[model samples]
Target: MRTLKKVGFSLISIILFALLSYVVLDFLVPKSNSSSSENEEIAQQQSRVFLDLVAVGDSLTEGVGDSTQRGGYVPLVADMLRTNPNVKNVQTANYGHAGDTSSQLMNLLEENEEAQADLKEANIITLTVGGNDLIRNFRQVGLNGSVEDFETTIQEYEENLNSIFSLLNQYNDEASIYIYGLYNPYHYYFAEFEGLQAVFDLWNERTVEIAENTDNVTFVEIDSLFNPSDAPTETEVESNSGDSLEDIQDTNHPYLFEDDLFHPNDSGYKVMASALREAIEKELEDTDSLLSMNR
Candidate 1:
């Protein structure tokens, strides 16, 4: 009897211990799951929720060289944004017009009520200007045009660009604005004219300065992506003994449209779209970091 009692007691003790262990494990498993779920929720919160993109400006934004007539980088960016798991949906409003200068864009911004409404609702705004302005100056003066010749044009462009930013802010202070920098399309035509390249560089510099001054403004540079060149200037041409224009000029640039050789072809627009997507992602990541820090 004593042996039996001892055996029973041992069995009971073992059963109790096993039950307790099971209960403890069950509780801990749930807690772990809850913690993991909470972490997932936090991560989701850090991601951008939605994007309402508004594209406004000149031929690039208007998708001039796009063979599909799909509005060039505008649609491409929207498609890219949709791939983000956090973004539920994406809507785009294209206000892009061909041959619009900065001043003309500003005027449109001030005058177009519909565009103003769209701006107010947009979360992302992309502007492409200054190309027409530069091209106009280039057309007027040609390769012989001095840097001084473009100074006046750049100054005017600066004022117009500032006004454009002001108008955008006035219409929608909450939206992030992205302005594209000008590329030297004429690089192919005037590779030896360092003056034109200098003018293009100066224009981009002024544009960057303007963008820096404005809040929530990002400048996207497409110069080097499409038309990268280190061709000799007029002075370099004079000094070099054996270098020919054909050697310096890269006529094989595949990005340019064969018809005009000025506008970006389909492949070129894809490049621009990629740049815009990267810029948007970077900006959003920075914003997420700030939000995480604040939390």
Candidate 2:
């Protein structure tokens, strides 16, 4: 009987020990989770150095071209980079209000307000500005429906851009600037607006000149990317979709591609993001290759 009693007591103790271990583990589990979350955050922060990128521009920078959340390509591009361990945590402050010209963008930078606090940490930038100026110029010359007088339009455009470039150096010359070259939207409207294919071509020519003058700046030639000749009419809007350009732009201005007639649809912005990614990848790869070669 005594032996039987000893076995019972041992069994009880073993059960109690198991229960206590479970209780202790339960308490520590939350701490483990907390530590894991912290580790993940650290890894994210360590993945990329561009923790802040301040984008100042017109509607495209604000993401007006696409019909998705985050509206345009910059955020999508940011999300794309954020997925890789070597390229995550690239943050941005998007100040791309609708109808803003280059001069207005300069003002936004100068003010350093409205999430302005984020600007100090900015390490890179992407923007598109010349389009609105050209449209406005076209309107002034009564070529509102056509791009007839693109030469005079381009001349004024260049002067405004020079001012914008000078202003950028003041903020952060170290930041790499990626400028999307002007698009060929007029072809979407008029094939030859008022005898002005020359004007449109000249406008792009000036941007190439602008890109050449600035050392840390490069032109992401978006003109050909949106080509009706090679690409379809519509574009894809979702961040993760495999939609084509022909799927996005159908009307004079898709609400997704443009907010009213002036801005781009969300789909348009998606295309921009798609284009921006190609440019950035090439640049970063070139930089890495050059570094490896020197070593």
Candidate 3:
């Protein structure tokens, strides 16, 4: 009878301890969740200010895929930014061309009346123009009938790229210029261009080195964001709705292109948008922390 009494006491003690533990955890959990909410609040508080973004490049920057703010990455990024009270009223300027090479882009930059006006108000710029340069170089190589053609093309590319960066920096001394690394779109679909991925890497590495020497400049890479499955099988929306890429035009140009299949599809644009969104958030977070430290 005495042993039974001891057993009953032991059981009661165990039950009491468990109840205490459960009560303590219940109290702590809400506070733990609130910490995350607090962090988001801080981020929101910092985002009330909007930064102006100016983008220059080929078709990718032009919103050829899903139609930009109406559709593609830039608009999505801007929308996301606005959600964080820290970022409000973001505007983007698109300076993109369908068949623009680096030299052509340089000419366009020199002639842009809007860019001149933009110099006064632009705070951020993103660039993704060099891919066309690679295409033109490769085309010239094919026409010239020698591998040596690539070397000359690269030399020209180097000079033009340097000048473009300097020009962008010159126009916007206070702006943060984010340049995108070239994507190997050829390798993305065609089986023959496997080695070109290395070429693209080398090109991106060079751009990174160039950006490293400059201040308030960063190079974003979208190659990693893409997968074979992410590529869109559909054509880009045309200038006129009826003139789509579904009809075969020529060997150099196919119906799969609004201008060219070389440009990204709507799916590709979404991928670009996703990558840009991540970049913007990370960058803003870092900037907010820096501002706090300064305070």
Candidate 4:
């Protein structure tokens, strides 16, 4: 009887010890995970930096064709910036005027105190100009015009762009400027007009060159997002799934334009916002990496 009692006691002791160990491990493991998560959150918060955005440009920047009417890419970008756990706050000022040319925008920048103040305080600036400039010429002469015809106009636009950059730098040299390149809305319509493509390509190339030459300037290329493959032939575009130009204007393919077949719809604006966001994130990453290396 004593031997049996001893055996029973040993078994009970082993079971109790095992249970106690499991209970202790369960409690400690969760605490360790919680502590690790808290540390990560704290580190992320510490790494976050505040952003101030200033948007200036033409009708596109003004959010003209967006059915949501939510201030186009401006609000979208602000929302994205807010999504970052690290971004403590995002302040935005938009001076996007409908039908404003580059010269007109420059005038506004020089004359408007509010815009100048915004630029001075901005950590990032976005521009969408030069489209109306070319569009006006196209409307006047149609595809019959040659690239050489716009030389003077292009030169003047370049000068205005330089002045715009100079003014922005003067207001805040540290602010990163993102300039959107022009996308040919009429590419499908004027596919046969080879000069049209040449002119648009030349304009984009010049815009890129200008951005590269300027400090803290990034040219956001949106042309490809609209024209995914090569410029579709007129027949191909016309026969695009049997949809009319008006029907396909907002159809998410071949035509990202609004009903007007010019301005971007809400979906199109989102794409623009995405591109801008990516560029901003990349710039921030590069800056962080440089700082870390220095440290």
Candidate 5:
């Protein structure tokens, strides 16, 4: 009877110790299932990709030239990104205004609440500036004007551009900026005016330098697209308008320019949109490559 009681006590003690140990371990250690679920949730969140594009610049961005009067390249880009399999969601905002210069853009960015919000949420940004800056100056001092005259303006533009970039980076460091290089509407009309082209080249070179130096910035070239090898025939120009050659120079490009000859027509907007899409596709590919390498 004593031996049996001792055996029974030993068995009960072992069971109690086992139960106590299980309780202690359950209290001390995290649950593996819950931990795994949380990790999965975090991973899923990390894997999701959203694209929000914010366009801030001049009339071209405002869809002024587009006969359809849609949202210009902003809507086109948004649509493209939405169709992209990698992008889970896409949003876009356009802050373009006619006759807006780099200085104006800087001021708007600093003061505009809506621009600030859009920029803060932007994953991509586009700019079209320096056209009005140069063109307005050209009107003030004809094509023969000395480069010295532009020195002050160029310096101010550079400062404004730097401030713009700084503000954008402050708002969202990851946002990619695509700045459209100025195209010479006067290329056909002023082909002989080497100084005019020279000015454009210099300005574009500086803009390219800025973009190259900045992170996530790209200079989109549209000069060649506007200035094709085969110039528009006299008949084409005459048919469109009876205006003199010089007067029609701006409005000559049937494909690219709107009736005003300055802003991009719908087709012109498409060209810009295509260029942006290509850049974005390249960026996505590069990202994918990096991710694969990481994996």
Candidate 6:
């Protein structure tokens, strides 16, 4: 009987020891995993920076012509930024309405709470305005939209843009604002219109002036990119009886979307993205920061 009792006690003790050992190992393993996870997070934070990029303006920013449904150059730019070794992640917000003009964008800036919040958090801003403003004026007045007509329109546009810049500065003064210059989408269709090119030039010039005067504002020129080397002159358009304007456009403007010839296709957006990326890289170098200014 005494022998039996000893055996029972020994078995109970062995079971208890096993349970205790299991408990200790479970606690230690979790602690080890937690420490490793924490170390990894710290390392990631040290090695990479995150950026919030906000793109605001018209159809160009909205990605109207892109079949992929991604917001045009905005996503392309974000993708490029992601490839940078220093950039860990990029959060992008696109507030591009197809028919929105500068004034409309101002209204959106004033009214939209979510956009306001994103703007406040933005490390960089890409703006594509003035094009719709010009387009709207031309539509309202027809071919009568001359340089003189555009002067008044441009003054209003400048006022609205200044308000926009002021609002953007107020939202996040540290953000670098990159605004695109106007390209004459009408130059091909209205090849006979004498003052059309001059109007686009004036608009772009005023836009450059505005950007120059604003703090941390950079003007990105895209007008020249759309002008194809094979584009015909006024005489060619008038003489080319073999091909229609649509055919000529199809042949000449490969970067333009076939559906509406106004907005850019995928390749065009790529070029714009490339231009934007170059500007951002240059800014980063100038400021002596990483790919994006961590604000």
- Candidate number with greatest lDDT: 6
Quote the positional error of residue 21 for candidate 2 in Å: 44
Better of 2 and 4 by TM-score: 4
Stretches > 4 Å off in candidate 5: 1-48, 230-251, 288-295
Which regions of candidate 2 deviate over 4 angstroms?
A: 1-48, 113-117, 142-152, 192-196, 230-262, 286-295
Q: Clashing pairs in model 3?
A: 46-86, 47-85, 47-86, 47-87, 48-85, 48-86, 73-273, 245-255
lDDT of 3 by residue, 203-240 (tens): 77778888888877777787655534444322432333
Clashing pairs in 4: none
lDDT of 1 by residue, 37-62 (tens): 99888887665467888999999999
Worst 10 residues of 5 by lDDT: 286-295
Clash counts per candidate, in order, are: 0, 25, 8, 0, 0, 0
lDDT of 1 at 215: 93
Task: Compute each candidate's TM-score over C-alphas.
Answer: 0.80, 0.66, 0.67, 0.80, 0.74, 0.78
Better of 2 and 4 by lDDT: 4
TM-score of 3: 0.67
* Model 5 local distance difference test score: 0.79
What is the model-wide C-alpha lDDT for candidate 2? 0.65
Each candidate: what lDDT?
0.83, 0.65, 0.65, 0.83, 0.79, 0.84
lDDT (0-100) at residue 34 of candidate 5? 84
Clashes, model 3: 8
lDDT of 5 by residue, 1-295 (tens): 9999999999999999999999999999888998989998787556546777789988888888877777677788777767765566777888999898999988899999999998877777888888888878888899877777687778888888888889888887877789989887766655666677778778888899899999889999877776776876545566678877767665566555545666777777787788788777677667663243222
Winner of 1 and 6 under lDDT: 6
Deviation from native of the Cα of residue 193 in model 1, angstroms: 1.2
